[model samples]
Target: MEHVYIGLGSNLADPAEQLRNAVQALGQLPDSVLVGVSAFYQSDSLLPGQPRYTNAVVALDSDLAPLALLDALQAIEIDQGRERHERWGPRTLDLDILLFGDRLIDEPRLKVPHYHMQARPFVLYPLAELAPVDLQLADGRTLKALLADCPFVGLERLPH
Candidate 1:
């Protein structure tokens, strides 16, 4: 099984519940088993003047191909009322495949490690939690070193 990381977020109605439902949907996918999840986090929106977002990371063991996993994620988002209007726009749900066992791929539709994941504290914080055992840096640098340098001022760990 290939270990994969996914970034989860919701800013629409019932954002917390929406995130919970997404985790459930992801757990039920064929050829995939939910391994663990990071604590939920609250962060300012990437888009200005938008509602704050609830973010989390999910660790999974999956046999699905990267593109196929992307398709599944798209379906999950659409089911939760996600619509793409502008870049970095708001959404009911957002699921991003962050990594696939260190393999790198660049396609018009996809980029391994998700193009901008490294720079986003919302994503990096949760990812660091989900895989605290090893800092698997998408960059050659260590995840531990990266975490130390990140200033996710707007991010806070939610109460359990």
Candidate 2:
């Protein structure tokens, strides 16, 4: 099994509930075991005029191949009413493959060590909670270094 981290976000239709439902679905993925989940956080949307997003990170150990895992995640998003109407637009659920083991992947449909993760506090902070202090990305960047660069700003930790 490979260690994987997934980033979850939602801004429409009761965001927190959406994340909760997504988490449950993640736990049921075939050939995967949901290991850890960080606390939920509320953060401003990437684009202005959109509702705040509820976000969290989950750790999974899966035997499934990377593309297969991505497919399963997309299926879960669709099942939860996700619509790709616009780039960075609001959605009921958004699941991203933040990291897939220590592999650096670049496929037409997927990119591991997710492109913009190092700079997003909503991604970094929650990831810090579940990742090791010495965690290193496939790209040679350390999780601790990334956290140092990305401060926890414009984010609110919701009660569990």
Candidate 3:
């Protein structure tokens, strides 16, 4: 089984509840075991005029292939009322496969290590909680180094 990290976010329809439900759904995935989940966090929307988002990271060990896993995540998003109307627009839920073990994937439909993860505080801080202190991406960047460059700004940790 390959260890994977998933990033979850929501800003519509009771954001926090959406994440909780998503976590439950993740635990039920076939050939996958949900391992760790970070504390929920609230962060300002990347785009102005949108509601702040609730985000968290989850760790999973799965035997499923990368593309198959991506498909599952997308299906979960759709099942939770996700719509594909705009780029980075507000949504009922957003689930992303942030990292897939130590493998580097560059598929047309998905990118491992998530292309913008190193620069997004919402992704980095929550990920830091579940990832190993010496975690290194397939691209050779260390999690500790990424955290040093990314500041925890515009984010609030919600009570568990």
Candidate 4:
């Protein structure tokens, strides 16, 4: 099995609950086992006119290849009534593949070790928690430190 990290977010229909359900749902996909999930965070919407988003990151051990994992994540979003009408649009659930075993894949349909990952507090905060073993950077700084250094606010850790 390969180590995979996924970023999750939701802004509609009980945002925190939506994130929780997505995490539970992801665990059931074939060839996958959820290893860790970070605390839920409420953040300002990245998209214009959208509601606040509850964000998280989940760690997993999975046999699926990168493309396959992307497909599975999309299926979960679809299951949650997500519709992609615009970039960064409102979502019932959003899943992003943040890392896939250090494989560094880039393709038309998928990118492992998600680009713009470290730039987003929502992604870094949760990923740092879920992948406690690996931490968030090759550099010495921590996710929490990066978060503090950045301008984003209102990050809080929570239990499942």
Cα lDDT, all candidates: 0.86, 0.96, 0.96, 0.81
Question: What is the model-wide C-alpha lDDT for candidate 1?
Answer: 0.86
Number of backbone collisions per candidate, in order?
Answer: 0, 0, 0, 0
What does candidate 4's lDDT look like per residue over 25-132, in tens digits?
988989999998888888778766889888999989999988888998999899888999977788899999988875767798876567777678888877777676
Kindly list the per-residue Cα lDDT of model 3 for residues 1-160, writing each as its tens digit: 9999999999999999999999999999999999999999999899999999999999999999999999999999999999999988999999999999999999899988899999999999999999986999999999999999999998999999
Q: Candidate 2 — which residues are off by over 4 angstroms? A: none
Higher-lDDT candidate among 3 and 4?
3
Could you tell which candidate, 1 or 4, scores higher by lDDT? 1
Write model 2 residue lDDT over 1-160, tens digit each, in one string: 9999999999999999999999999999999999999999999998989999999999999999999999999999999999998877899999999999999999998999999998899999999899997999999999999999998899999999
Clashing pairs in 1: none
Report each candidate's C-alpha RMSD, comma-separated, in the order given: 1.4, 0.6, 0.5, 2.8
Which sections of candidate 3 miss by over 4 Å?
none
Query: Which regions in candidate 1 have their CA more than 4 angstroms from the true location?
Result: none
Rate residue 155 of model 1 by lDDT.
Answer: 89
Please give the distance, in angstroms, between residue 95's alpha carbon in candidate 4 and its true position after superposition: 0.5
85: Cα error in model 1, Å: 1.7
